[model samples]
Target: MTTRDALQTQLEQGIAALGLHLPADAVPRLLDYQALLERWNAAYNLTAVRDPAEMVTRHLLDSLAILPYVQGRTLADLGTGPGLPGIVLAIAAPGREILLVDSNGKKVRFLREAIRALKLDGVRAVQSRVEDVEGQYDCVTARAFASLADMLGWGGHLLAPDGIWLAMKGKRPDDELAGIPAGFGLRGTHELAVPGLSAERHLLVLGHA
Candidate 1:
């Protein structure tokens, strides 16, 4: 039963049906980052879902269903193409400090070869373009990229000052939450049930109004 033991038995029954209490080496480093993103999506198509059991329900349980609203100590995924949920929340929260950001270039060269083959540490990819990325960041993720007022008008100075911007999305946009843009607000909108995914997921959760 090896294909990383059938994707670690479908990521341990979808993290025990999303009660989620990860880190028993986070399901073998999320099945070794889904076998290095399905061996670099067979030469950099990065992701079109390409079945590794639909990359475990559309890329690792739709990127760990926002892993319990990820807080603090640096994050910053912004258009992180291949590294959804910023390399699956830096492989299930290995003490924060993620920073993926992407401008393409073969999906930032497969996110720096899956953060150097998942040794992962604090993690870091950066090809730039999230409005020329710089610093600040207690948290800030993005997934269907633009349109939360153009993703907080392009990375909203990389979040900090009580950060938090999560955003992955699918349905419930409500006109991108009424075009949020006066500093920012709407700190709630969750609705994810990924497990084997039925589609129509959401996350939203913004901050700093």
Candidate 2:
């Protein structure tokens, strides 16, 4: 089998292990996105994950691990470099308004291309600093983008009064949690077990106190 086919099988198995069901075309589209990223990375260096198999575990499954925690209608993926969970979430969750926010011109350009190529509806990419982004969303996601405190400090305004912030981290950021700004409280911290990946992954769920 080709490497792409192997990656696709891995992705399918990983999604099943997570107890999640996606559309029939979801897996194919996701693989297509990975292919696109691989082609773009050759020129733009969008992500450090170069291996297609590694991308399946590290990028695709890691992002989809938090699919259950994603709530509400609108989501803003702040500092979404190469659209990690943002783009993945858009493809997995249809009919939800997802906005990919990044300040890097090159990354934004790549995100726009992915959106257009994937033919994803109800999703858009904007080039702007997280702190300067306008409009409120029901959910906001940041994956290793910044410290929890700094992330909330900069893009906190973008979250609606009752919105949820899903922050993906490598370890349990107890120190970061201690520094959470006032008015925002830690709702929960979930240990994510991404299939085929053994690294420690935690999902910090935050909301207005």
Candidate 3:
């Protein structure tokens, strides 16, 4: 199979099995992101997932796994290093507004290029600290940003009063949960069984209960 074909197969089985729908069109968009990541990594160090196939499973599939639980018309990806769940979700969801925020200028530059190259609609790349952005979002999704407490402390102001926080973690984050800020309540948690890869994944939802 071609490299893209293999990755698509993996995404189909892995993500679809989890009830996450990634259509055929998403494959090329992901391929475009992988290619851009590779090109930018030479200068910006976008992501560590070097091989394209690995990018499909580890980066693309892992990001798309959160689709089922992401219920929002607008989302802010805090500390979106090279745009994980944010950019991928932008492509998958189409009409949703996605704002990818990062402190690093190079990564934001790469994200902007990826957005343009992929022709993603309703997506914006903001080069600023998470705390610096002044806007409300229906949801704030992040992958490997910081501790759950820190994430709430920094991105809490950006979330609308009714907004939810979708934080992705590897393994159950007991310590981080224990460190959650006083007011932000934990609504629920979902253990994601990603296909074609062996890794523990969890999504924590925080909101006013």
Candidate 4:
């Protein structure tokens, strides 16, 4: 079997462990997304993970691990570098609309291509800074975008009042959370171990309180 096949097997086991049913059809789309990401990375510096095998765990599964906790009518991904959680979520959870925003033109271009290539009808890629975004979404998600405080200061505006902000981070974000200004309350924090990944991962859910 190819290395990619091994990775897919590992990812499938991880999904099974989570007790979530990933439809058989979604596998091909995830692979397509990985291919697009590898193609774009060659020219646009879209992502560091090149091998499809690594992409499954580092990019696809890692992003999808937070799928169960997302709460929003619509989701907006801020600084959506190569459409990490945004595109991944749109594929995993059909029916929900996803707006993926990034300031980098090259990244946004790649995002648009990935969306088109995947034939994901629920996703819209936009080129804009999070701070300058005008509309509100039911939920806002950011990964490796900025510090929690800075993210709250800018990305917070993009979230609806009742919406939650899903922040994916490494290690415990206690120090960063301490820096956030008053008003936002921590709804819940959970450690997620990505299948095929040994690193520390946590998903922080914050709400306006």
Candidate 5:
């Protein structure tokens, strides 16, 4: 059928493969967000993954895979370029105040438009470096933003005590594991499965040491 239909099927199957259920409107909203990003990408070059089908696997499903570990009522998605997991998470599961942080002006502008166009409540986007942004969140997320040590070092203060940090990375970051800075301990590492994706994907969970 059409390309959009194909992407829709891929997203649906991917969600099921992850053994997660989403609200009826969730899927449509997700596709809408993708469309919006795609339009903006034409002008801003928001993300490297330009293919719609690839976006389904690399962007949408990859983000959805971490849904189980996204705890706490407030979450800060640092270096959330074009709002990868942040926007994806906000759509997949409603509620939980989400802050999408990025240093890029174009990306943040795109993020705001996406938030409003999607009619997403409790979600906001800000243009600021991860380190400059203030306030604590019950959960913090970084998608390969920086080294384990550097990411925690810059944004570690944002994570509330007993909060969880979900660092999304490809393959197990064995080398960077040792660099996890002081006061932050590795909670665990989880392998994520995204349908139609065979490449390695891992999520490093961290908390107070």
Candidate 6:
């Protein structure tokens, strides 16, 4: 298989399974982003998934799994290290204005390069703590290592009154459910089926209570 066929086919199959409608160029551009990330990983150590095939499953497909939950015309990805769902979302579904926020200088550097290399328009990266981030967005996303309460506590204000928050979590975060602060209420909990990925994944949908 050619380089494209090797992982691109896998990604295409995964996308098909997820039933996401992406642009014709979306798959190619997604692979381009993956290649760029692989190159940067050697020096910057952007992500831990070192194997390219694993990258396709864990990074690209994992991000695309939540496309259905994303809403509105604008998005901000909090603690977007190397632009996981933000960059992936920008490629798969363009037109929305995107902000990728990360406190790590190295990851931000990789993100800026990915933006330019991918020619991802309407996407910007800012190096700031989520709480320090300014402006509101129609949608907000976070891949959780933090509990629901802490994540919302830091970036809750960034969500517009009518907006949705797509919080990606591994396994069901039942323990953290009760910790969801007062203002935000759980909208839905989705069990994500990621092709070739065995890890449990869930997307917590939250909105203003």
Can you list the residue pairs that collide in candidate 6? Answer: none
- How high is the CA lDDT of each candidate model? 0.85, 0.94, 0.85, 0.84, 0.93, 0.93
Question: lDDT tens digits, residues 130-174, model 2?
Answer: 998999999999999999889999999989999999999998999
Ranking by TM-score: 2, 6, 5, 4, 3, 1
Which residue runs does candidate 2 get wrong by more than 4 Å? none
Quick one: RMSD of model 1? 13.9
lDDT of 3 at 103: 94
Once model 5 is optimally superposed onto the true structure by TM-score, how far is the C-alpha of residue 31 displaced, in angstroms?
0.4
Instruction: Show model 4 residue runs off by greater than 4 Å.
Output: none
TM-score of 3: 0.94
Alpha carbon deviation, residue 32, candidate 5 (Å): 0.4
Q: Tens digit of lDDT per residue, candidate 1, span 1-209? A: 86678878988899889888877787888888888888878977888878788888888888887888988988888888888888887888788778888888898888888888888888888787998889989889898888899989888888988888988888979887878888889978888988887879988888888
Superposed Cα deviation of residue 83, candidate 3 (Å): 0.8
**1-209 in candidate 4: lDDT tens per residue?**
87667766877787787667776677667877887788779887788887777788889889989999887679999988999899988888877789999999999998988888888888898898788888888888988788889998887777788999999998978888787757787888999988888999999998887
- Overlapping backbone residue pairs in candidate 5 total 0
lDDT score at residue 71, model 3, on the 0-100 scale: 81
Candidate RMSDs in Å, in order, are 13.9, 0.7, 1.5, 1.4, 0.8, 0.8
Candidate 6, TM-score vs. the true structure? Answer: 0.98
Candidate 1 regions off by >4 Å? 8-10, 20-36, 41-62, 67-77, 86-101, 108-128, 132-140, 143-153, 157-164, 167-182, 185-204
TM-score per candidate = 0.34, 0.99, 0.94, 0.94, 0.98, 0.98
Model 3 accuracy (lDDT, Cα) = 0.85
The alpha-carbon lDDT assigned to residue 35 of candidate 2 equals: 96
Per-residue lDDT tens digits for candidate 3, residues 38-138, read 77887777787788778778888888888888887889999889989898888777888889999998888888988898998899999998888989999
* Stretches > 4 Å off in candidate 6: none
Report the Cα lDDT for candidate 4: 0.84
